[model samples]
Target: MTKTVAHIEKVLEVANSTSAAALSRLAASWRRSAERHGLDPGEHRGPRRLEGTHLCERLGAFEKLMTVAAPRLDNLYSLVGQSGCAVLLTDDDGVVLDQRISAADTAVFEAWGLCVGADWSERHEGTNGIGTCLAEQRRVIIHRDEHFYARNTAMSCIDAPIYGAEGQIMAALDVSSARADQTEAFNRLIGAQVAQTARAIEEANFRAAFEKARIVVAESDDAEAATLLAVDDHDLIIGATREARRVFGFDPLGALAPRPANDVLGRADGPTGFEKAERAAVIRALTRAGGNVSEAARQLGIGRATLYRRMKRLGLDQT
Candidate 1:
């Protein structure tokens, strides 16, 4: 056996044994995948690619996601490029939607089959970054020889999962490098960056999905870590980011139900906060009720005259 494969076999032996002392969580995942999928660490498997109609259909289904994620992917690339890495965006199914590879490193990346429309699911690509992150539904760093397959030992990978407004995983953002060997500190740094970028993408997606709702950005010590809540015209929470749900101590499933925004966010202490929130709520009500003044009034639990007065005061009458 080759040296690399021999090393992998020994690692697997340790992983499969009863003693889990030396096995990292990721290594344990590799073992679980081996048992579940009957994977062979010794063999190199090329990533599967969807072709022709299948490829087109997959792309079509993910068109909206691509549109929302492209700019964020570009930004992530700029941040990680200095470290000789590229960014990849993939759908929940592990079908790559898009990639950003530096022109100088195109050949190196292409050789590993990191390209648009390629399937990188765990079933197809073994224990690589993108696939494993989706399988585990968490952030991961697969550095060098940590990869299950011997052939993938040369590259280092970091990936983070992006959750949808409904709390389901929507995609994975991966940053990978083959230029230089990666250290644990560097992996952690890049992993954090990847996760932050993924959260930004999720926030964008949340806003896009609730474009007409009043977006409530909750107060946070870390602006990047703030939670986003979408409140309808009746001041009821319609949707929220996963972080928002967690930070605000909300039940994940209960976030779907329409609850008073003030009940969750707490009423503003002064007139300024109250008036702004009230005006925003009125506008949202009008929007959700489709500009029907009577419907809007009903939703706001106010008479038509009151609704009209609020609109006039808020300068929404001009629109």
Candidate 2:
């Protein structure tokens, strides 16, 4: 095994019997190294579009908005520091558009295949910050136990969706990480920032869909127009806003779990737009893990060998 992987394994050794906080020291060490060399996760990807010359037509507007949002996001991401904070932006289809992250969490992010060009639609990718936020159509802050991918269980993720002018689901925003200083307050703050960013984009378009999913309300610089609603499958709405009731066609009483972007719009049995090769790969990963590699894997399934292979293939940190 490479030295880095060996080191991470050692931490896992202690972690096997220690608290989740035990991983902080290793994260701190990796953070220092990643800072000097830089580990830019997430691939800067283009939107998924229908075939034809109209591709630009589908992407141009969102692209412009993301470009504008990027700088402010950069400012926001700076607050993340080395706290294992990772920020990601995705279109309604769950294709990642942009992302930013802290150095401490770089190794883990890359290991999970979070590059910009990656596709995270629910079926293929399982449940995660980006996918769950998009699928559930509500802001979610998942820490540990909530992860869908067994290998990802160790992570703490907070994801919020963005919206366009008419309230269409434009995209989703997510922050995933594992480290010290991870708290509910921190999660709420990030969720709120993402919500504001979504609303800013929404003012520009109304046909937005998942962009409206799970969008948290940004801090009220003035009298904010956004609202936060909780919904499940029933479309019953609950929570803080006239905007939420108006935007999502929610019932006043029922609620299940609404991941709007992840809604099964097509065939229920088979995979959806984002489900394909990734699903097969995840299955293979589970099978290969033999169910013993938590840190090396995601929620649970991770073997030293599998982790090494994935790291090599995905160009993740050797350590």
Candidate 3:
């Protein structure tokens, strides 16, 4: 029996015997590919590609992501390109929007349906790197014969999902290698870099989304997770990254309700009352006037004597 046929029989044997929930991630993906997606492990057809006009439309929709991901893609490819790897960025639906590949390997990747506009979603391409990562919403590495389709068993794929500003899965960053000499240890190392690059792209897009707001990193046990919040001048939380939203108990997909930064961060808001408000207002005016009592009084719309009396009553004289 041929190797491809033997691989197909093995895949079918495991897929039919084990329930998806009872299997490992790889086996679960295999089960989904064979049963849910209705894909044959022996199928030899290439991946589906979007036509010119449709691909153009998808590219337009992903303009911001492509822009932010360009430098990241270049940097990742620079690290892995010499290893006969191709770096690709795909939209949320798994359509390749951008890629970086060396001239010598272009024909090889193109022949394997790793070109721009190719669909790599699990439903279409089965359990491969980009598709499975999107489906599982996490970083994944599919090496060689681990691939669901026999034709795709020659390539190794490492992928990470890129989350959007609103904490949605917006894109995927992938590094794929067709070299027969690729090893699992090397794949793990490259997988870490791919995940980090994906996080950088997510942060850049998040900062761009809230350009005018102050970006603050939320304290978390998982430092590797991107836990960020965007606060406006008024000290209201205007935006949050996916990890931050989960960390702070904010609505993941709904619009932020503009909660006080102190309240969300669990910090003390200090004294609250008319006296405190008056004290704060007077102090702000005094600071803004460079501690000139006369100018401070003028700014506060009060007589100098009246301001002095209020400041003293508010315990400002002690300071």
Candidate 4:
């Protein structure tokens, strides 16, 4: 097995050996941190589906989301020294779901937004991100020089997969930094914390989208199902089409939806003629010029700042 996978198996093995009280004390920060990712603290009981795994295997946002995980687990990694990057999460299939890195140190990972939506299948990129976690189903840390990707070899990452009630692989959580210590204690702490963070997100998504009486997150399996679910909820949802994502600059088919209707407008229906009237005229000229604010300003006989002000007032997705 690769280093990442081997790490996961070992973490699980050791975690299983701990008592329930001990584990809870160990993961206390995890429970509190999940609430930040939009999960209810009352929901997380413990690692319920973590056993009976000899036969089976599996695994799995935001700056707003990261703020929650950071304070809870900060002491885990940065105890001795600072890390270049912090937490990461991946979906059930080992796709790099979302990341939170220090803005000052972001360039190290942003070679091409390396931690956002990148898949971690051994077949795709290599044994990185949660690819090896999906392979091993536990917490693992592939520190600097242990990574298989030549470019990623300089980085150290600790990863763990979280599971749901049905024992399905929900997500993966990770913490990373460029620094390496001979002890690797920080990796162990941060990797375990990341796994707890994923567990929290899974629980949050379940409570928010799945249990909600009205709201529904549209999954990609069937467009028809989303269409059917969104019948009377039109005012609440923006619909699950590429047009909606592109119109708003939102990543398409996302679970952590952007601002809700109440956030965008006092009332659901915008001014009936607003888009086609003043805003429409501005947008038309802007679109004609291919979103060139300066050109659109000249076409509309307005200053660049004036054009920008109008877009914000109208809440146009793109200027």
Candidate 5:
């Protein structure tokens, strides 16, 4: 209890101070946020819960994404809930859209206001796992007294942002424990696991959103860091994952897609006109055939020579 009070006092000192660099980047960030929101160290604000039509409307907006993510999130919950943690999925605006809590922990988590429809945005709840992760646009661990509000001092949480196909934050996944005194390494491990789970949820959502589009998954040696890009029939890049944008050098905040895939994928001189789609199909067939030209041609119902010519036209033969 004394340690908790001391941590709060330190955070308050940082928050009240105007001098920069008094705290490290993350600590200073939380302090500044508390100052901006006028949060009092002595006060423990209750979560703002949306109800009725407002709650329904907010949840309705995320129906498609929720459908894609709910099952995967449930799997994640099962993986971590044994530790007395509650898994929460919050929409882009920081409203809890879905949750998974064991019956044994439900009452305890409800006391911390982690139920669906609860608002955990930084502006509303001060610096918390979900809100701060979204605010920083990164994964984070807000453990116990590290939270900006005194009310949240008993909670230990790790959060990771879930990005949409358009490379923007679609939601946040958080696993928070009611247990106290968790080591930093333990918290970091939970953060890493949550990040991986969030990536899987994002990939699943991307596939569902572009079910008919040509989805290309680019994977690095790390394997777990694969990137997904969806290209339409017109050979336009319709969607890209956050990893795709970061790894492939595409603008995340660009227009609502339909960008030419060839230009984005470094294939400006590869194909043109009506042949672009055909070239893609041939390449896919060749890849499926393990680069056996004859087999690829046969699969496309075309002669070997015709396939060679098409590949030449698309600049694939030289490569």
Candidate 6:
């Protein structure tokens, strides 16, 4: 049997396996591709490409993301382009919005439907890197025969999901290579870079969304995912990253209700109180004034003597 026939048979065998618990992520994805997506592993048809007005509309929807991600895509390509890889950025629906590929590899990637306007969602393309990453909302590496489709088995893809400012997946960053000698270890290294670049794009988008808010990094066990919070001038948490929302119990979608930063961070203040707010205001004024009592009092629009008395009452140190 040819390699394609062998790969098709292998995919069918794994998809029909009964041991669901023991299946690896790739196996699970294969099963999903066969059962959920109803994809034919033996199919040799190329991916569908949106053209003309349809392509432009899809690109327009992700214009902001493409703008923020352009530089990142360039940098990632610089790192991996020499390896005969193509860098692609796709919207949440798996429509490729932007791509960077060396001229030498352009025809090859285009032939494989890795160009702009091509759809790579799991439902369309089976268990490939970009598709599966967006499907599972995580980073993924689909190397060679790990792809459900026999035709896609020659390429290796590394991808990471990029989350928008609202803590939802807005795009995916993918690097694909058709090199025959690519190894899993090398793919892992590329996967790390892809994941880091995706996070950088996510952070840039988040920062732009809350330009006036103070961005703080929250503690997280997963280094690949960013845990961030955006605080307003009043110390209210106005926004959070996906991981932060998951970790801190914030609403995963929609506008977040403003909560005191201290409360969310589990600091000393349990609830907002008049005294706490007043003390916080005084502390902020003092900090802004570089600990100068007169300047702080002026900023607070209170007499120095009154400010000192309030400080004393609030147990603030006046050195």
Residues 120-216 of candidate 4: C-alpha lDDT, one tens digit per residue: 5433434454556666666667765444334455567677665432234556676667554433676676655565555455444433333332222
Per-residue error (Å), model 4, residue 148: 2.0
Pick by TM-score: 3 or 4, better one = 3
- Poorly placed runs, candidate 6 (over 4 Å): 20-22, 269-319
Cα deviation at 70, candidate 2, in Å, is 1.2
Best by TM-score: 6
- Which residue ranges in model 3 land beyond 4 Å of their true spot? 19-21, 268-319
lDDT per residue for candidate 2 within 271-293, as digits (tens), equals 43223433344445556656444
RMSD from true fold, candidate 6: 5.5
Greater-lDDT candidate between 5 and 6: 6
Better-scoring candidate (lDDT), 3 or 5: 3
- In each prediction, how many residue pairs overlap at the backbone (N, C-alpha, C within less than 3 A)? 1, 49, 0, 3, 0, 0
lDDT of each: 0.78, 0.52, 0.87, 0.48, 0.79, 0.86
| Candidate 2 runs further than 4 Å off | 1-61, 204-319
Q: lDDT rank, highest first?
A: 3, 6, 5, 1, 2, 4
Tens digits of per-residue lDDT for model 6, 1-319: 9988999998988888858515588888899999988999998899988999999988888888788889989999999999999999999989899999999989999999999999999999999999999999888999998899998988999999999887888899999997999999999999999999999999888888888776767667788887778876565789988988988888898778999865665435542333465678789999999999999988866678878877885779875
Per-prediction TM-score: 0.78, 0.46, 0.83, 0.40, 0.80, 0.84
RMSD of each: 6.4, 24.5, 7.7, 16.6, 5.2, 5.5
In candidate 5 the C-alpha lDDT for residue 206 amounts to: 85
Clashing pairs in 4: 60-90, 60-171, 60-172
Report the lDDT tens digits of candidate 5 across residue range 1-319.
6765777787777776766436465566666567677676666558999989999999999998889888888888888888788899999989999999999989988888999999999888878999988888888888887787777888998998888877788799999998766677888888878989888888888898888776666644444453777766555777777777776667865545578755665645543322455667788899999999999977866678877866875768733
TM-score of 1: 0.78
Residue 60 in model 4: lDDT: 16
Better of 1 and 4 by TM-score: 1
